[model samples]
Target chain A: MASSKAQAGQTLWAKMPKANAELFALTYGSLVTELVRDYEDPIEVNAQLERIGHSIGVRCVDELLSKADSSNLGSAVTQCGNLRDTAEVVSKVGFRMFLGIQAEVGGYSQDQRSFSIYLQENPLSTFVELPTIGDEQSSSSPSGGLDDLRKLKYSNLYCGVIRGALEMVNLKVECTIVRDTLKGDELNEIRVELKEVLSDGAGDDYKEE
Target chain B: MTVHAIHIFDRKGKTLFTKRYTTTKQQLMQDAEQVSEQRKLIFGMLFSLRELVGSLTPEGGSPALQSVKTGAGTLHCYETISGLRIALYTNNNPVMNTLPGARAAGGESTSITSFQTALKYIYSEIWVECVVRSPLYRPEDIQVDPLEGRDNNAGRFDIKSTNFEVKLDAYLSSMPWFR
Candidate 1:
């Protein structure tokens, strides 16, 4: 069967399955807000959040790839693609499947070792407010310069998600937050660097991005 | 709209986690053994029903059976591409039950998809955070040791149930149907 996404060319983005950004925002907000209440150190909470995202990524990949198999889309791009094609499928198809958004793919390395997925819009930011350094806050020096340097990395969870998802798909990739709206950047870009391919090519027999 | 309980089962019909909330019925399960037995039975029934429905439909059916109502309550199920199965069992609201002619004729399919979706998010958001990321819990440890009498006990992963319980309570309480 042709993918529902492919059939609706002109209105594909509009036709794609969408969820209320509020739902994700609130859920993520709750987790983040709770971490703030529990840990005195925001940096520690940042690491924990990424770790949590990694766990989520591994399982989310399971949900994504398996569902794709049922639709036959999983096999069409299954494996045997060069690094560029794999990255393209991941940034384009995978993003659409999960978040109902398309990512801009660019900044690929000549050695085929890295690429970046630019998220023009972030659904996870609906409820995210960059934490401000209170005037009386003692975590940083009196100078706001030091405070600015101490970024909370609210979207690091997403970086971990990329790493976790890629690892599960048999591509050992290091996912890093190249840019994030949380830190005043206009775009949320995640740079994915291939570390090593696992012994089993696709993780599963025919797992796609 | 209230989620009574959420159960995650592996491919072999073993229970991974079955967290009950205020909405779950008491008489259906009296003790731990009874709870496990009832879960096993529910798993078996759902498995059979899925196969039955799949066989009855043609190629490309309208997304597997959505929800089914039994005499007790309603069962909303979501199956992952992998073998993990998450089922949300909820009791019919007393108010809905009292509506005349509604019970006999069968009511409309509840918008339980939202609840199912939330549960899937919970699987990724909470369960993975608690079970998969924690140093205390090992994925390999989720196994059965008959001699130790921990059969089908989710491989002794030692889940921090209290944390999940608190969050689930908060999550259900936040839903509009909780009252």
Candidate 2:
């Protein structure tokens, strides 16, 4: 009986190890691609890339500390309270490190009355490449191409890192990436907007939920 | 750490020219010798009478003898005679994202009639290293191969000049670095 339990534990560990490795690889690869597509100079690009990743690490460390509340873990283990905290930590650290950037705390819509953060930059703007084909010409225009691009699904690789790090903290929060035109510096602002979906208390509904 | 130079290669395996920094000092005597060799080779490859000299000059002293430094992270640029350009930059600065589409089109390639006007952009921004272009011919000519020889790499692409509408593959393939 003891050996059977041990075998089950080992199988569980083996099954998850590959998934975690794949996630790490994907996160690192995407981070590199995003950097390459955006920057021209390698030195500045590489330095900023590492700095951003480092900032993620630093914030993740703090999040782990608070969530785990284990003194023994010390600085050796990285943690976070949840995916939301992880995203918040990354965004905060990245802003502070680059462009001397910062975000302002604000309340949600006049009716919602929820809390949120707002990024501010004047010269900063998001970059969107216009398609070379026909009808796409107006895409470069402020309202035409650029606006549509802004609404496209944002791939927040940093948020993925935050999510992965927070998993270490045993915290999971569904995260979304939202873009705000108000944020400048062409900065790719990552908003960890959280959501909660309520479902009927049935096992069948739980799967759909 | 200080960066002394950046070497860039295009999709055609051609070496655009190396961007030599004339300001920073060479760290060791061995490194100084390497720079001297590179300088001689660059001087021999001069194509046009109006050589676009890119120099990083020190505030004082002869720029030629200044120290050239190498560090873990720094940006570098290399340009092809046919107007193909590649740059490698440190991954840390937020400004890196601003250079790809419009900012990189700094009028250098305006006169190159034969070259395609396709822009090839690539980077590992999280690590601060990347490459960008103004514009080029054929959208398909630009490729970002993975560091690993894996097929399932998500972000990597295989851009070729033949994939473009214009044909600058021969010119690009004949670059100094390609040899």
Candidate 3:
């Protein structure tokens, strides 16, 4: 299962139109900085970034589905059966196809309702670091020096993207950044918890004669 | 072989587009209300049938309903991962599977797979091009209740765009079994 999907992701990544990686990373960094400046509050900036990512995710899903099945055999629908499959698609196919990066899926909860995606290489954060306030940094060193860095999830946009994309496929999920490399964690991990499987809204009111 | 009709439904079981051919069997319904009622019945039946199929499958995977054959006709369905469903109604006695020698070698399954492939092509190539990628198309508008008795074109959405209609007709007509 893993090898086939990884191969599929690699092929798709190869087929996708190329973009400059540095330029892409810098653009995202600029956007986040602008958001921080505009929002002032770290929490608000994170929320705004997520909102932007959510809209992107909504559209991204269609593009992913269309491209994933280059064979166009309508097999894309049957690929992801449950939460496990969804995670594999998102981490393997989704990340590689879009970002040209491989994300590992691990840390699955016993119930199978939740899982974590670990990003060993986060392109968006390659050139980003939380700026510390002068003097306040020295005084607040004991209090975890950079309070904003603690609150601001620099790559929180990924959480929203995952949530929105899964929702489009009728899987309502909650994504939280459990660990961030920007915050000195070894890896960037996003925990996804399945909240519900939305009914297709095939209205029960419709009665067949 | 005769392609009788086609129906496209969104994930919400709302009919996005419907077209019927082969009216020789019966006159087309003149009443818009009657046509919509028929669409509703078809969607409801498909929804329940899918659930039934899902329950019967031991593996309990996604609801896989490839086709439903009745004395009248056969319904071939292909659902994208996004829940966009394309269903085609064709005559039960498909000419492609009737070759005497081919029947011994599982020709029926081959024909069904081919039909599904055709449906997928319609979706990924035609629908995605003319509708999903169209700048004027609005995905949000699909939520509006057509049963609310709004304008005649309210429920039609962007799928009825001239470009989509032309492309769909061309593709369907190109099929070997389309009559």
Better of 1 and 3 by TM-score: 3
lDDT of each: 0.63, 0.33, 0.76
Report the alpha-carbon TM-score of model 2 versus the true structure. 0.24
Q: Per-candidate TM vs. native?
A: 0.50, 0.24, 0.80
TM-score ranking, best first:
3, 1, 2
lDDT of 1 by residue, B20-78 (tens): 66544564457666666677778878788887886888865544655678787788776
lDDT of 2 by residue, B1-179 (tens): 12234334432223333433334444344454454345333322321111223244433422211111145433333332212234433222212223335434444543111111121211111101112222232112233322323556444333332222122233223222211
A22-72 per-residue lDDT for model 1 (tens digits): 987888878876776566466776788888887777766665554454334
Best by DockQ: 3
Q: State which candidate, 1 or 2, has the greater lDDT.
A: 1
Docking quality level of the chain pair in candidate 2 = incorrect
Query: Runs in model 3 with CA error above 4 Å?
Result: A33-40, A70-82, A135-150, A204-209, B22-29, B60-63, B94-109, B134-138, B143-157, B160-162
Q: Ranking under DockQ, best-scoring first?
A: 3, 1, 2
DockQ of 1: 0.05
After TM-score superposition, the amount by which residue B104's alpha carbon in candidate 3 deviates from its true location, in angstroms, is: 21
Candidate 3, residue A22: the lDDT equals 88
